[model samples]
Target: MEDTEVREVTTSAAKTNDPDGRRMQLLNYGIQTSIKKCLSAVRYARIEKVLSPIAQSSPEILKQIHKQMECQLQTNIMDEISSMFEEENISGLMNNLDKIIEETSLGPDEQAWRPSGDPSLDVLPHVYSTKLKERSSLEKILKEVEDKNRQLHEALRPRQQRLETLKKDVLKECQYWEEAAGAIPEDYKQKMEKFIRT
Candidate 1:
């Protein structure tokens, strides 16, 4: 009798654990798949944004595309996750996501929607973590480019100022010579002759 009860208990425990373990595995797989899809979409959007002449030419359109893509990805991922929840909850969540996409696509004036308050969506932050790494790398490159630009600008400033001063002096001297009966000034003529010989 004791052996039979122990076997039954063991079997029941295995049955319960199996379903939970499978559920967790499925959940993990779902999250990973969603992140991969989102990242792939982002990559495509970036490529399109870079390669398209319209996006390259107009900054406003690029910004709008960026905003729309961001909202679209978030909404897409949420909609996927909503499938795991109740039917009623799914519709409400989807409606909220649609509203958010519309608002984001329209402009910044609309009320922003966030997933931070939802505990079940914690995995979504990982998607942005990858973006943050890329952003940091890009920021480093941008800083280097900006520093080089500043150095180039600084190096050129004194030369530019000197050239401007020399040009003004030359113009004034030319005007004086012109007013003085069109004959080249003796001192200026000697400088021009020396410059030509050099």
Candidate 2:
């Protein structure tokens, strides 16, 4: 019986393809793919973290920052001009000139200058233009993000199928080993088990 079982095992092993080698290859590929995905996720998370403030800021806050930057630039320019001319009153003169220009452009009731009709159209033309551009840019970014997500899902579909196949193959291999173990003599099985444990 032992001789017969040993011959059967050898015959079965000889007839089959190298499933253990294939399984190891698949396992290694899976591990490498997982590590690559983890690295990609980490990179994406870092980029998102860096851009989050810019993406999440309100338009009003952005506008305020723009205004502050312009003010700072103007102040710097005035300082430079004042230093170049060696003039003490140039700063005050520049401020007065700016006030006069603003008054002429905006008039007494700046609110009256707003576009009449739909409340949405009441905003200044330049402000509305900037808002429209911002909206389109955000929409474009959203579309691109959606397209990338869809592409990623499509790309992973094959890998997912392969993983499922690997799982089934592993189970089948386990079943084959269990059947072979069952066919062994009790004393030999115990010895095999002890060897495996050690």
Candidate 3:
């Protein structure tokens, strides 16, 4: 009874994870089929070589030839597997698996799967909430900084205009004084009189 129940449960789990199961099955099937095909090809090549005219009809020579063929077949299989991995770029998959293995082996205190003692350290919610909080804080800080910059610009606008006006007034006064001094009719008394009036 227990065995049947366990079998039913296993079947239900497999059904639920059908996609993962299918992927694993397909990979296994491909590897096994490739190996079988390689063996068949090697067998055919050996038979052909044995029947060929160049085949020295000696047992030792035949054995050496067969050994070379097997090595070649093994090399071909390795090449095929390597090509498959290269095409798929299995490095990322390997990295992810390594992370999973590392996580699994970590101590309870360090594992992210389990709670880390603090209520705020709950896994999924905490991670997402922390991210959201950080995002909102950044946006808030950016907005405040922009507002302060705008306020500073507004405050400086009138002061800048006032400074420009003061500069123009000073330049005009200087020019007038220069012209009046140059126009002093070679008479120091007239110049002193004008200066006293101003």
Q: What is the C-alpha lDDT of each candidate?
A: 0.69, 0.64, 0.71
lDDT of 2: 0.64
lDDT of 2 at 158: 100
TM-score of each: 0.32, 0.33, 0.31
Which is better, 1 or 2, measured by lDDT? 1
The numbered model that scores best in TM-score is 2
Model 1 Cα lDDT, one tens digit per residue, 102-164? 666846576655667777586666678897999999999999999999999999999999999
Which window of ten consecutive residues has the lowest lDDT sum in model 1? 19-28
Q: What is the descending lDDT order? A: 3, 1, 2
What's model 1's overall lDDT?
A: 0.69
Give per-residue CA lDDT, model 2, range 3-112, as digits (tens).
56545554554478533232233333444455545444534335435657763765456556555755665566556754853556543554566566666785555655
Q: How many clashes (backbone atoms < 3 Å, residues ≥3 apart in a chain or on different chains) does model 2 have?
A: 0
Output the lDDT of residue 65, model 2: 58
Ranking by TM-score: 2, 1, 3
- Global Cα lDDT for candidate 3: 0.71
